[model samples]
Target: MGKSLYSQIGSLQNDLNATVGSTENTQPSSKVNRVTRDAEVTKQQILDAAVIEFAKNGLFGARTDAIAKSAGVAPRMIYYYFQSKEGLYQAVLEQPASEFQQMLEQMNLEELPAIEALQVFLRTVIAYEISHRYQGMLLFQEANQNQGKYFQQTNWSQPLTYVTKILEKGMQEGTFCKQDPYMTTLTIAGICVFYANAYENLKHLTPDVELLSDEMIERYTQAAINLVLNGVLA
Candidate 1:
């Protein structure tokens, strides 16, 4: 109801639009191109369509036929590629997390001190959430609909544990103040995720302003950084 919240929502809407591929003007590929590459392309198409449908309509309300139609593929292709609608949803969320894991593997965690590590980690988390808006939408939906129980059972659980481990290591090395690692991780996640979901509210709260522009995203990212690092760093 506040302008600040409304501004955040406007930003989120823009991010969501970018994430769902709605902003792209993709033409249908030739049916003659039904090679292995074509199959993978079609599979991505179906998943992209599914993200739009599922984000707007929830799981039970999302129709496979509509997803197939939007994707320019047969309805059966959705099932053939993903096994089920829910399977496709899980894939959408898991794919980005897998990428995050790869990025983490390439990083030298021990080299960065606690404050810098937290800053970099939080930046990555926020950037990923902004870029992969559909994944955030799906994760939010799962959290509300299943109360986070479903996520707890999936590969989604790995990131939280990873963050906790980093926090513990920082504490052991006297780089961060003593505190509950899990709680700190939850706090960081909440600040990024709650703003995303409540973007509509943020938009209303901050009247007469554009919140999704490049400059505004930079501001939001910095504000998030200030909040988390200030309290955790020794």
Candidate 2:
């Protein structure tokens, strides 16, 4: 066994850290840092494997043994870290949800006029989902098959709330045709989300096209934005 996985990951982290500001900004490598990085590396390994398993088999159907094998860790490690299968699934759900929220926070979508905000939101969400297509499949399973039992437990409404606010703003300004913001928000989300969630089906449109390639993503993003803007236009 040459360099272990942790060794490889640690080396990569070192390289990444080196690219940071001037050498004066660097901290001396410490034992604690290495230990912490390795632990996080292990956890990320488990999450990455769990995404694949959960996407293929919904929460009730996914197996710990399979996840452990795919993660190259002992089955016990999953229990030790996550406490239970549900807990692990929650972590998977949480990571991406939190990331999207953070991305939203950074975007300041509320500052823009409703129409511009809507376009930005549509493009942002479509791109986000396309980049994480596997997670989109996992989300589809949870939403449809699991009845969103796990998702509802999360702060999943933040994005929808953002959309609703934008919609209400547009309606108020007479830029968008008046409609129920909450209902319209759901409709708009379905429009953007379906492209990624139904990717497996969409891929069969023609064998020649790479549905997730950069060109297709832009096309899909623009199409979704256009559809929503057209429907809402005053």
RMSD each, Å: 7.8, 7.7
For candidate 1, the clash count comes to 20
What is residue 24's positional error in candidate 1, in angstroms? 30
Question: How do the residues 22-108 of candidate 2 rate in per-residue lDDT, one tens digit apiece?
Answer: 323336655556666667778888988999899889898999999999999999999989999999998998777776776777678
TM-score of each: 0.77, 0.82
- Tens digit of per-residue lDDT, candidate 1, span 153-225: 5676566776787788888888878999988889888887655566666878887766655567667878998
Error of 2 at 83 (Å): 0.7
lDDT of all the models against the reference?
A: 0.69, 0.80
Q: Where does candidate 2 have its weakest 10-residue lDDT segment?
A: 1-10
The deviation in Å at residue 114 for candidate 2 is 1.5
The list of candidate 1 runs beyond 4 A from truth reads 1-34
